[model samples]
Each structure stands twice: as structure tokens, then as C-alpha cells.
Target: MEALVDHVKTLAKSCDAKTRREILDQLQSLCHSIESPDDTVQRISFLNLQLAGLRIGADLKLFNILSESSSPLTIDQISKNTKENAVLLGIHRTLEHSYTLYQEVDKDAFTANNVCKTLATIGAQAAIHHYFDAMGPGIQELPDLLKDTQYADPEDITNTGIQRAWKTDLSLFLWFQEQPEELSHFQHYLTMNRSGRPIFLDVYPVLEKTETNMDPERALFVDVRGGTSHDIQEWKPWHKDFIQPQTAKGAKFYYMRNIMYDWPDDKCRLNLKHLIDAMGPDSFILIDEMVLPNSGVHWQMAQLDMLMMAVLAARERTHEQWSKLLESAGLKINNIYTYADTLKDSIIEAVPL
Candidate 1:
């Protein structure tokens, strides 16, 4: 264990990208070797507590309290400062190992780490609010929902995990419509997810490579069901004159980012058919989503796929699944462009048959 720890220290100082990858793989192996079955079971059992604590900390402004301070603060000081009860303050202290969301500098003193600083941002806080306050209870009730007859096979978005958890027949959009204030919070959550991760524009440079000399008046971008147009602004650096242009027939590419994973296969097929109808024979539909593998799944992507199941009765697709999905809609895969080293983000380019 000491040797592994020392090796990690050495690898941290090495600037080579390949060396970094080696270090991560070695660390993962070392971690598994040291971790006992009991430890693993305990961690899994306490996961719900960890998630609840994170939401609680966000609500209590615990991160903010530590972030604004010059040094680590005692739990009492934090409680006193926030005018929160001491018992409530104890929840966050236990989450020190969850993520570097918070750090325990001493036995009972705490401070914010870089990850915790992100929670201090307005957008992240809004996301926390939407997730915990609006969506949490329903997510927690997923097991009971699965047992219920009405939601036994929640394939449709209307009769989904969210509906079962919330004990409502209303779809997610309709629920948000009734609670307009929640609508903005939910929209903010979407923005936080879209902006916090990798930018798809950078992954596909073809937009800039091809759009530079094209006619400005011709529609180069169409944001179908685009909310707030944040992505359009991000795309503008590549094509400055992109102004919600016309038909998918004339457009070189039809782009959909982080959209398909929210719905099941049927809904995805329906949406794909629309994109196929809009496309010319040569035009492509670019889907930005995680494409999972058949085996040795990465934990983050796997958890996300599971959460999609629990929350929306949806899933992240595998390459074979994506190919089949596209084929069902009369589309064929042209090429897949992956960003970073993870399966969490990829661009699936498909053309109408």
C-alpha cells in the first residue's frame, strides 16, 4: 500500500499524458486489491446517504460557508455562521470521502475543495435544487414504482419512473408546466448539464471546416426543440451568421446534443424518423450521447444509464443498439466521433437511406 501511494505521488509530478493513463490504471488495480468485500458492501449501502448529504449540504450553503472562509472551520462555527442546527451540520462532515466536494483538514474541521467550489456557483445550486427538491422523491420510489401495476412496464414517457415516483400521471413537461417556477429551475439544470461537460462543437470541427465559405443567408443551423438557445450561441463561433435557418433538406448537418438519452427506444425512433424526413438523402443527423459498450463498462457511464432507467425509463445506448435504432428509422451510420477518452460522450453521424 505504501509503495502504491508513493508511486502515485511520483506519477503526479510526471507531465506525460501516457504516464498519467498508466498511473490511473495502476491506481484502480491497487484500490481494488486493498478494498475488502465488507468495505464494498458498506459503501454501496451508504450511497443513498451520500447523495442525500450532498443535496443537504447544497441546501444549507455548507460549501459556501467553507468557500468564503480563509481556513478550515469547526462544525460549531459552521452551524453558528449559517444559523443552522448543529445536528444538520453533521451530515456534510460525513461526506468528506464521497468526492473532494469537501475536505476534512483536521479531525473535526472542514473546508471546501475544488469540487465543492463548483456547488457554490448559481447554476450548480439550481441543478441541486431541481434534482433534490423536485426530482428526488420520485427517484427514491423507483422500486415501488416497478412493483405497481400501472407502471409495471414504464416504456412510455407519460407512464414512466418519474410519474410513478411523483404519484402523478402527468408527464415531466406537464408537471413542470403546472409549476412554472420549477420550469425555470429544470431549464437551469439542463443548461448546467449541457455547459458543464465537453462541448460537441469542438469534437466535430467539420462544421467550421465546411461552413466558413458557405452562403451566410442559407440556414446552417436549426435548433429543434432548443431551449434558451445556449447551444446556438456556442455554435456561433464556428458560423457567426447561423440564425435558426430553414429546412434540414438544405442543411449540411442536423445536430442533436444530449437529447436522445432522455427517452426510450420508441420515442427515439419517432424523433429519428422526423429527422430522417427532414434530411436530404446525403444529409446527416449527428446524435451527441454516451454510447456504452457490451462489457467492462465505465462506472460513471453505467451509473448514468441506470439513473436514466430509474428516473425516465430510458437508457444510454451501445454502438450496436445505436446502429439498430438508426436502422429502424431508415438511417445508416456514417461514422462515430468520440470525444475525450470516455464513452460518456460521442457523436453518432447517420444519413437517411
Candidate 2:
């Protein structure tokens, strides 16, 4: 095992991006191999403080301050810098003790390490904000959401997890729109996380590969907004409600990303109806989202599937599933251009049937 560890360390020093991920997966598998069932339970149950601690640390600019400091900081210095009391910042200390993301020069003193510096980045902070603040509270209600539905797959967007948690009937996006800052958090989160993901345009040549009737419809692309505020209006120009796209007919493209996956088939069909109503024969509805394979699903996507269920009573669709949903919704899929080999984020182009 020592030899194996040394080998992994050697491989890690020279491994490419793909190999690094494989090593990570292998490490996880190895971790599970050594754990007893009770250890597994304890790990899951006792780790609830991780998100809260990390997010609270980020909230107080703990990572930012630590990463920027010239040397290790005592708890007193950190508390003074953050305008927060040391007792309250103990959560941040607990996080460091568990994760070792910071260098502990002495008791109650810490300095930023590589992992801590990464967390200090704007992108990482955005991710922690979205997952912990925006989604965590509602995700805790997943058991109740499942229990109330009698363990069946969820159907309605109006009665989903977030709705139940917030005690509101508005859909997730609509509810976020009503909030002052949450909507911005979600948008910033998406912007940061989209950095390395697959892009449909990289693979699909809209003109050469479209292979559709290019008549009557003038060429125009409409990008739907997930949750937009004036802060993000500059990030995108075409800001339309996702639930009610209100697009111009005869437009060449009506593109939506990561929208369909957050909906049940029935609700997705209803939402697609809006696009179909406004689509010409030459027009296409481009759904850019993950199409999970029936087998060998990545944990990232699998966890997202759970997240959709936990949050919005939605499930990420497989290829056959996507086909079935779209065909039933009155759209004929022309082609599916999958850009990412790992996560299978793809562009499913279809025309009104």
C-alpha cells in the first residue's frame, strides 16, 4: 500500500487532466474500500458541518483574508479583520482542522494553503454560495418531498422541494426573481462553473450540420435567461423568462441550457410547447443539457440527478428519456450533438412536429 501510494504520487506529478480525475475516482473507491458500514454512516452524518462551515467562512471573507495575509494569523487577528467575534469564527477553525486546507502554525493560528487559496477565488466562492446558501436549506426537505409523494417520481414544479421549504407556490426561477440577491447568486454561480464545461457550438456547425429547411425563418438566436437582474443584464442581452420564453416566431434558434433537466417530463413538455408554438419549420429548439447514458453514469451527473430531485422534483434525463420526452412533446429530434465525453452535455436540436 505504501508502494501504491508512492506510485500514485509519482503518477499524479505527471498525469494529464483526464488521469487526474481517474486518480480522484480511484482514491474515492479506495476510501470506501477501507471504511466499515458504521464509518460510512458516521462520515455522512457527521459531515453536515462541512458545507455550513466552508460557506460561513466564505461569507465572512475568511478565505479571502487568510489567502491575502503576509503570514499566519491568530484567531484574534482574523476576528478583528472580519469584524466577527472569535467564538463565532470557531466554525471556520473546525473546518480547517478537518480539511487541513490551511497551515496551522500554532494552536488557534492558521495560514492559507493551496486549497484555501483556491477557495478564495471568486469562482469557488460563487459555487459555495449557490450550493450552501441558495440550495442547501431546501435540499434538507428532500425526505419530506419524497414522503409526501409516496416515494413516486415527482410531477409538479409548483409543489417541489424549494417551494415547500420556502412555503411558496411560484416556480424556482420565479421565486428567485422575487428575491433581491439570491437570483444574482445563482447567475454568478452558473457563470463561474461554465468555464470548462462542454459547449455545443464547438461541435455543432449550425449551418453546415443543421441539415434542415432554411426557408421563411430569418436567422436569429434567442438565449433564455434563467434568473437575471440588472447586474447580469450586461452578461446577456436576450433576457426572457424560462417558463414563458415569449420568443419571436420564425427565429432560427431558440436555445436553452440546463433548463429541461430541472423539470419533470410533463412540465418539460408544457414548457417546450411555448417554443413549438413560436417555431417555424426552419426554426429549431436547441436544448443544451446533459443526456446521461443508461449505464456508467458519472458521479457528478448522478449527484446532479439527485440534486434535481431534491430541489425541484426533477430528474436528469438519459438519451432515450430525452428522445421520449421531446417526441411526446411534439418535437422531432434532428440530431443530438454531444460535446463533453465525460458528462455528456449535449445540444439536442429539434423542429416542431
Tell me the TM-score of each prediction against the true structure.
Answer: 0.81, 0.84
Candidate 2 local lDDT, 1-353, one digit each (tens): 89989999899889876688789898999899999999899878866678778887888898999999999999999999999978877766876668777888898898999889988988788788888876887888888878877888877777777887888888787798898687777767777777665567778786673556655445466676444433224334365676685566766777787778877887688778888888766777888889899888889989999988877778998888888898898887888898876678888988866
TM-score of 2: 0.84
Local distance difference test scores for all models = 0.71, 0.79
Deviation (Å) of 300 in candidate 2:
1.6
The parts of candidate 1 lying over 4 Å away from their true place are 1-6, 9-33, 87-101, 148-153, 180-185, 194-197, 205-217, 234-249
Give the runs in model 2 whose Cα sits over 4 Å from its true position.
1-10, 13-16, 83-92, 105-109, 210-217, 224-247
| Residue pairs with clashing backbones, model 2 | none
Residues 11-34, model 1: lDDT tens digits:
678756446755776677777789
